[model samples]
Target: MTEYGRQPVERQLPTEEARDLIALVRELADREIRPHTAEEEAAGHFPRPLFTLLSESGLLGLPYPEEFGGGEQPYEVYLQVLEELAAARLTVGLGVSVHTLACHALANFGTKEQRAEHLPAMLGGGLLGAYCLSEPASGSDAASLRTRAERDGDTWTVNGTKAWITHGGVADFYTLIARTGADGPRGITAFLVPGDAAGLSAAAPERKMGMNGSPTAQLHFDGVRISDDRRLGDEGQGFTVALSALDAGRLGIAACAIGVAQAALDEALAYTAERRQFGRPISDFQGLRFMLADMATQIEAGRALYLEAARRRDNGLAYSKQAAMAKLFCTDAAMRITTDAVQLLGGYGYTVDFPVERLMREAKVLQIVEGTNQIQRMVIGRHLVGPESR
Candidate 1:
């Protein structure tokens, strides 16, 4: 089988430890992920064992605190690890990202007892998690989500459906948001619900264009019961928790986008260097050379943008706008770079035999997930000019 491996990326690390972490991640990706990506993706088989291995290796919680079984790495370092994994396979990379997002609320806002009780297993004890926020009627308008929870005698019963949930059926836990009181964002609350909780069931995974190895499904909660101790923060705080997670989650998506873009650029470079036309390598053609240069430039720019945002996050600066910009730009760049890769490979790029076509399909989803690029623009605009007048 042809190798669809990524070229090594030159990263700027803050410390020797970080450098070693990236090296370890790349080694693991090469050994465990890249080799099986094509076949598993083709079969639409989720690699549950690989996730277990990642959990054991401590790669599943790089950005969280170490006291609770996390690696305690900075956002900058954690995101680079994500890029490396994503370059190997989007399923693994994005799966890690979503898991981290799922852990955000509890790690950041839960009581000390709450964190001690759950975070270790969730982070590194081989448990996978899913984030639940979007609903069928609410995507960009997350505050309008209709999922509700009612509290009675220290027990909360949750009943609603969460849609577009990554790792839906397979996750061991879910960080869920539900309306607990009023009608809007102010009425919502966050909860940590076990995947196997009574009345919690996942629909069949959605048939998707790419990343088939990762499941996306709708979760139905019919009287799913949880103790009040499972609530992450005060009632009316779910939206705040959700938005905070999303800011960091957007950076994760940005990094994954650049990783996919870098992979596509590498494929194009490798293909162009080999394919001959008019008795010369097509890479020698100025037109294709310019295209490759443009692709590389865009990927580099996207990487830098996300890294800048990550730095801000690591420094406790406000980065919501930067994160939105990074998500908007990097995912769009990934789509363009992957499409160009297909064009570079010509007919072969369109065939299943080549990875570029799969890369292209995968790139399309990055633009829509996390937050659509259109929503991203609105986010950035809101930061610049304030909320739009109703």
Candidate 2:
């Protein structure tokens, strides 16, 4: 059996500090994450303790400000870290991405007092978070969500269901988006709701084809009340907050997609080099060699595309189009690359004995989450041609 996992990826990091960080991540993944990934994922277990370790290591909040216990790294460096983690285990990488998304509204738009009070623990104090925007009836059309938050004196009473929440029952806090005024985008508002708050509960986790170690479920807020201070951004500004977070979140997904693809390619290369056919290594075949070359090229292109978008975000440039393109292309590439890896392995790839089968399943969800590839294309199209006519 091939001992399959991450291979050393030559990276173009900007600083020695960033290089050290990547080294630490690789060491941690090899020791703690990669060894148990197949077993834990098969058992459908969430690695809560590993997240606490990541928080303590200051790996959870790399892109946020240092004052609030974040590492204060640029997106360019932070995204590369995510790729390394995803290469080891998608559960940990994507969980960190979702937690960062949960923090975006408050980190970027909340008052100083809010940041001072909550950001520290949320960032590096080992608290996990969830972002709640989609609902049973409103997935792609997030602005049309029906979750309502009605104000009563100094408190707001929230009632509705949030679907497909990543951290769901396991989160310490939730960044919730609910309707506060009229219909459509303008009426929406964002709130920081405690996961253990009264009337807040999670449904059983969804049965997923992959990433079983990460729970995805629906959360119910039936008369959940929160103080007005927990509101993020101005009233009627929730949609803007959600969109900004998503633009950044899309880049995280793109990096993760490349990581999965890289892992698949590594597996394929290792298997082909060792498995002999007709008294020679199967990798000696010209047809297989060409397939390996194409896989490598696609992975490289996807990495470059996402890194460019990350650089744009770091420079404060408009990157929604690039982010969408990266998310779309990288995820599509991951699916194709993993499928090819399966083919390269022949019968072994179809079996759970190899990691490629699981990698393929995990890659499928990346295209669907953080806005489906179709939604990504729509976002890219709107950027180029403007919104459709009414």
Candidate 2 residue lDDT tens string, 1-390? 255545699999999999999999999999999998899999999999999999999988999999999999999899999999999999999999999999999999999999999999999999999999999999999999999999998899999999999999999999999999999999999999998999999999999999999999999999999999999999999999999999999999999999999999999999999999999999999999999999999999999999999999999999999999999999999999999999999999999999999999999999999999999999999998999899
| The candidate that achieves the highest lDDT relative to the unseen native structure | 2
Q: How far off is model 1, as Cα RMSD?
A: 0.7
When summed lDDT is taken over every stretch of 10 residues in candidate 1, the lowest stretch is 1-10
What is candidate 2's TM-score against the reference? Answer: 0.99
Name the runs in model 2 displaced over 4 angstroms: none
Please give, for residues 99-208, the per-residue lDDT of candidate 1 as tens digits.
99999999999999999999999999999999999999999999999999999989999999999999999999999999998888899999999989989999999999
TM-scores for every candidate against the unseen true structure: 0.99, 0.99
Cα misplacement distance, residue 237 of candidate 2 (Å): 0.2
* Every candidate's lDDT: 0.94, 0.95
Clash numbers, per candidate: 0, 0
Report RMSD for candidate 2. Answer: 0.8
Superposed by TM-score, candidate 1 places the C-alpha of residue 327 at a distance from the truth, in angstroms, of 0.3
